[model samples]
Target: MDMKRSLLRAGLVLAVALGAGHLMQKLADSRTHTAELATPQPKKIEKVSAGPQAAPAPSPAAPQVALAALTAETPKLPPLTLLPRLPVLAPPAAAKPAPEASVAPDCTPRLSLTATPRAMITLALNAPCAPGQRVVLRHAGLVVAERLDAKGQLSLDLPALDDAGQVSVLFSDASITTASAALPDTPLPRRFAVQWMADDSFQLRAVEAGQHYGDPDNVSTEAPVSARGGYLISLGDPTLDLPMLAQIYTWPADAKTTADPVIEAAVTEVTCGRDLLGETVQSRDGKATVTELTVAMPGCDALGDILVLNNLAGNVTLAAQN
Candidate 1:
């Protein structure tokens, strides 16, 4: 036939170029197994063109896959709005009590003595007294007396007091100068009473009975009831004119007319018999006269020569003054 048809067209071109080189080695062995299975598989992105979409650049694997999904996902946070408050106080009160003071009382008493009577009671010391001081007689609450040397001088003993009362004597040491008196209750008379007679040529007479006369309203019968003739009489009752009597006289020292009349002048009632001499004259009718005087007398002492005649009846007559 033409050569046998030219050898079958060269085996049909070599069978079509061996099938196109086996399909290009099977598409390069499936692209080397898809790059070894995409080398551990994490690349899957598919966002084609959603208009305006270009933010894809951070990939070191996309920062390790967004730090492992931000360390495995747990954070959405926001909600707590401001908070804090606490404080309040009040409580306290209670306290009180105090008061009391007042004092005064010292009755005072102490006094007892034996012999101290020269009479001296002058106490004056209104404070500040020391020296065995003890004196009390409040109103007879009796403690009586003390105080010897420290001289606030107190030497008492006038007690026996009867009437005029009023006494307060207190001084128990701190010398408050205390002492008072107003005593006087009848009992201070030892006798003294006479009346009348001045002279009949004075003699002597003094006889008081039941003596005990002190304040006969302050006595002073003007003294002088006769002592020596020149007369001074005031016997305002010295106990009833010294025991009543009369006239008497005797003068005969060998009288040769010792100047005449020796005793003459008589009346009745005669009881005058106690030795009398010249210058005797007692005539109120009771008769007596011996005054013919030869005058020779000097200091005569015959228990006579006394002429104190307080006449005018205040009776005081101690006659005999020759």
Candidate 2:
């Protein structure tokens, strides 16, 4: 029983010793905590001012430090070099204005007039710039329209109305050329022309002292040149669009010759039922007289008949015979 009691006492003592050691450890931890609390730690203290704070001064080496940092981080580059300036050239002299196009020597028309036999004037025209151009020929009071040849040339004989012959050519562009010629002094036969617009409506007939009314010896275009006392010459081309028709009658200028010139109208289909209008130009005693006339035609029933108009041309009598 004593041994049991001793063993029990030993267990109780071990328990008390363990409890005391636990209490001492807890006391030591408490003291350490309290000591740490009692000691003062270093703390940053900030001043709270009521006014605006001044900006801090910049560091002396800040720029150099930043420059060094930038130089280290950036890659090395070649040194810059400026290219040589190019010479400025004066703008090329204003290109000499191209010489104005020269005018052709033959551009202007050339006109010439020459006296010819039988009191006629020869008209010559050279218009290199106006090939095949229609032009109006004006002489005294007479006017005629004709076209130039392919080579811009024209040559024609025109009866001289005046001793001092002056002719003018008018182009469609309103440009005109003029020329004059002196006619010969030789005496010309008494002549006259009957002009009309109709192609074949009018006929000029001259009855000489030895000729009958319908005889072949009467002066007509178809009569033989020598058989008839007077001669008839037809002028103008009937093929033109507006053909100008003229029938010229010439008689001897001698005082002994007596002649009766008449204008006859044929009653063809073209003039059967229409009136004909015409003009007469007579060159007598170195003077020209122009007269307008209108002849009444017979109806269609008289298609084959011929009407003689007496007053159209007066009787030709020399001054010495009169």
Candidate 3:
């Protein structure tokens, strides 16, 4: 019985040792499988054959992404600001023109002339602003100096020297006025004229063929208008300074008796012991002759005495009576 018990204990010890060994071996194998699952391994490459074969279709590309969908994840910005507009301007206005000034009219002197009878001319002057002025009248070779009236007017008659009458007047201010006319009358009668300066120093004495001194047919300065012979016309303004004086003797157009002319000088206070100057104009047969004359005066002692000039006036002729 003792031997059988010892053999049973040995068998049990051998069985426990075998079971522990098997358990340790199974735990080691489980740890090795977990490690292999955590780590990856590289894929292996395979070689193809050298012969030709059909190729496979390629795979499609990936689709593109949209901008809205891309920017949806970015931050947003604020709106921009704007400025206001300015106003426009216009142009300036035009300038105005200036006005013109006014002027006055001119006032100058005027003269007029007209025709008259008997181959004469009528000169009329009107100078309202120039009164009492001296004026000289001229026609052909005859000149007469006179003065304007108190009314600044003058009217006179002048013998026409030309068929187409040409007359002129000269003023003291050196202004000249002229006129013209036509004279178609018959010839004038025989005339004798004498022009002198001193008033009472000279005398023209006319004596008919058989007339005596102081007779009705005698003509002299004292008796200018004679009934039986020629008449006399005197012209002058003695009040003027250095006056011009004239005397004319006109014989009848149908006279049968020859009338002689005699010039006499009487010494006076104004013409004492001085030479007397004068001009004589004789018109006959439609023609005229002008002669300048100078006469010597006596001494102042014989102031009232008369001196006769013989050769002053030439001889006179008359038509024979039937």
Candidate 4:
């Protein structure tokens, strides 16, 4: 019994062992099939990873394209060579200067005089006067002498004429005669001599010793000599007539003389201011008529010797002496 039990135990043990071995073999076979199927799927997944990995690495190259796009975003600038240039022109020339003009000449007249001590009077005749007039000397409203020269000048020698009183001298044409008288007066000779005052003026007095006589018969011893002719006779033949002498007496030794009497007579006296008279009376040199009478009497003021007479228009200007 013990032996049989031992054998039985042994067999049992062998059967269990064999059954375990067979079960192990079946598990191994199932594991091998699952491994094979899993292997093929793993290989497919590997192929998908490899193909997608190639696409991802190619996307990294897109950053280089992005960098090129960033460079294109900036604005571009143009070159400076397209600017335009300005043109230059020449300047204009300067203007020329104007020329100067001319002026007219002045024909003003002048007079001068001098006196001496010996009472022998020396008279000087000056400009703008006709060369054919006579100079008559008077004292105390009495005519002392007459003088005429070839150049319308007069010179007289007076010794007995008193200088303490005033003397007057008048110039007039010698060829004149009184209209009341039919026959003309006799032509008187030239040259005369008489006494003079201390102030160089003439007074009614006798002729002096050194003086030459012009009219000896007509002379008075108490009064001054009445000489018919003197130096003024040499001027020319007179053409004026003596109607009535308008005499003006002066004060005692006033020391004033005037040539305005001549100018005033020619401008305002009688018919001298009239156009008919100026045309009728002939000028000395056949020049313009005596439309303007100018006088220059030295040592005389208040009235100048300038007389501008327009007989045609009857206009006159008697300027005051300066």
The parts of candidate 1 lying over 4 Å away from their true place are: 1-94, 101-133, 136-143, 146-160, 173-322
Model 1 lDDT at residue 308: 31
State every prediction's TM-score relative to the real structure.
0.15, 0.59, 0.57, 0.21
Question: What is the lDDT for 271 in model 1?
Answer: 15
| Predicted candidate 1 versus true structure: per-residue lDDT over 1-322, tens digit per residue | 7776777777777777788788888889999999888888658867586578679888565334334445666887898876655444444444444444554433333233322222112233322243444444322211223333453344333321212223455554343333344223233211111211222122322222222222122112232221211111221122322222222111212223121111221111221323223222331111222222122222323323323332312232332333
CA error at residue 253 for candidate 1, angstroms: 60
For residues 67-114, write the lDDT of model 2, one tens digit per residue: 444455677799999999999999888878889998766579999998
Local lDDT at 319 for model 1: 28
TM-score of 1: 0.15
Predicted model with the maximum TM-score: 2
Runs of candidate 4 with Cα error greater than 4 angstroms are: 1-113, 140-150, 164-167, 172-322
User: How much is 311 displaced in model 3, in angstroms?
Assistant: 5.7
| lDDT by residue (tens digit), candidate 4, 173-275 | 4422211111112221111221211112211112222333223532233322223211111111123332211212111122231111111222223223223
TM-score of 2: 0.59
Residue 68, model 1: lDDT of 45
- Point to the candidate with the largest lDDT: 2
- How displaced is residue 225 in candidate 1, in Å? 45
